[model samples]
Target: MLNPIDLHYEWFGVLWLEEENHFPIIVGYWFSKERSEITQDAILSGFSTWTEIGDHSMIMRMYQSIRNKQKKQDWEKRTRLSLRTIFNSPWNEVSPGLYLIKSRDTYPLHVSAILKKKFWVWLEHTAVCETKEELQAFMQRVHEEHQMEISMKNTKPKFL
Candidate 1:
């Protein structure tokens, strides 16, 4: 019997990590009302609670997570849509099982990237701007949200 590590977050419930494994075996329900997406790595590392993972970084995680969800044959058999098709971009496979998809064109308020673990997976994260100013504003909002979450998690019932 393995003891679950309960991370006190609204979305995340009990996290189960194997004693021998460095990676998490089971990371509880991942849900977020915030527009920004957090990654499993960040969740396991507790970085998600304090810092925002960049869109590019999230994209990599999304790709890897989706690939890990099922065997290649099983995944291909299940859907006609490739990951590239789902991403709606001509993603370059920089290395084996690694992808790179970025646009040089800049558009204000434009949705730059959309990432998800799988097609049916409701959890998705997106990058929403093409400019430094927009990115800064977005990060600011994320920082504020993280701070609020931390404060709420730290709040306890004062039994007088």
Candidate 2:
């Protein structure tokens, strides 16, 4: 099985050509990690970890800095209701398959981006905070709740 590998010197993942004697051309980054596969051309071109940094409002000009920008404006623009936008600043993953997003326009407008992967990906989410404390609390609560539900389902009581 062709597993996605993390890129060197970056916090991202990439799929490289495994064929020996062939250039390790990137295929694509891990998007869903489910049913998503690298396309022929896409494999050649490849993709990096799509991270956002710097002033993403209108693309700021930077001189020399440690942090770098990785947002694909063109791609994000095409995708509607994107978690990241001029309005929404902090959109992050709280847990695996779960994302917590918030924006200034809708202050305290907590939204969730749930990754439903049947074949590829279908993001589904519903609301929290800009603070790390709030985010952590929210995530912990959700995780506990989910565990409880799973436990309940597994423990089938036998009626006397």
Candidate 3:
């Protein structure tokens, strides 16, 4: 049996973030009836890539240290939402370190796709707000997009 509330928000939406680095990484996470499936594809098969370039000089040193072993940069999970990040992806990159930060908040809404196995989504990384007010604005825009989807589904074209 599934909880009514959980079932309703299971299929919210999907977004991907691709960070540019020596070894680029693309992560796609989906929300399923199983919370374990909410990984958004953070699984590790071989080597991992660190997206945030927090302290440029420090990151450079970290890069040097892991340059051979692979997956060097150590990231701070708590500040993924407010750091200075640089996203080279085609999606709308926003802020400096936002790609790593805001990506965490996405937990509220489940993935929007039917994911079978872990895969990569090339959607451009973008976060249009920094503060709560700004986040609300961005969310409002998302809401509008959601309404558009619903509207399209509910309405049908007339045949002459």
Candidate 4:
């Protein structure tokens, strides 16, 4: 789970950071999600686009900012929090140099459509896979799963 302290806050928006090779930097407002879906769709969508380009010159990460639920304007008090949820979450090395991370802290609770309460989520990915064989195995499993889903969708139900 995310830090227990996060329960007191809600997501404010997303912060996108880009690491450029050169010292020069360019920043812009990307997108924001307010009381929106808490799923990792936003992160994965951006990551997919990043992978397609195969851009080694730049690296990108998304951070979600949190704001206190209580209303109080105290200049001395800290009320805002931002964390790299995806990267900071726990990861297990499935294979050598191959890491796997789940998207939620607790399975059923975090999988709900609209969160009634706060829960932790981490973006899943293979942190590192040195060989095409390992990557291929992952891709092949996905393909097989997709095929099964399609087959199930096309099947006619045998009503009694």
Query: Which candidate has the highest TM-score of all?
Result: 2
lDDT of 3 at 107: 29
TM-score of each: 0.20, 0.23, 0.19, 0.15
Task: Tell me the whole-model lDDT of each prediction, alpha carbons only.
Answer: 0.32, 0.32, 0.29, 0.26
lDDT of 4 at 3: 21
Worst 10 residues of 2 by lDDT: 151-160
lDDT per residue (tens digit) for residues 27-143 in model 4: 222232343442244554553232222232332222212212111111123221123332232211111121222223332111101101133232222212223463345445434
Tens digit per residue, CA lDDT, model 3, 11-128: 3212234456644332332346654443344443222443433354653443334322321111111122111112222112322111112422432321111101112222122232
Which candidate number maximizes lDDT? 1
* Runs of candidate 4 exceeding 4 Å displacement: 1-127, 148-160
Ranking by TM-score: 2, 1, 3, 4
- What does candidate 1's lDDT look like per residue over 1-160, in tens digits? 0011221223322233345656534543343333333255446657445333345654345434543452233212322334444343222211112111223233433211112234321111123343668555644543453332211111121110
Residues 89-115 of candidate 2 have per-residue lDDT tens digits of 122212224333333332233433333
Worst 10 residues of 3 by lDDT: 151-160
Error of 3 at 116 (Å): 11
- Candidate 3 off by > 4 Å: 1-125, 148-160
Question: What C-alpha lDDT, on a 0 to 100 scale, does residue 143 get in candidate 2?
Answer: 59
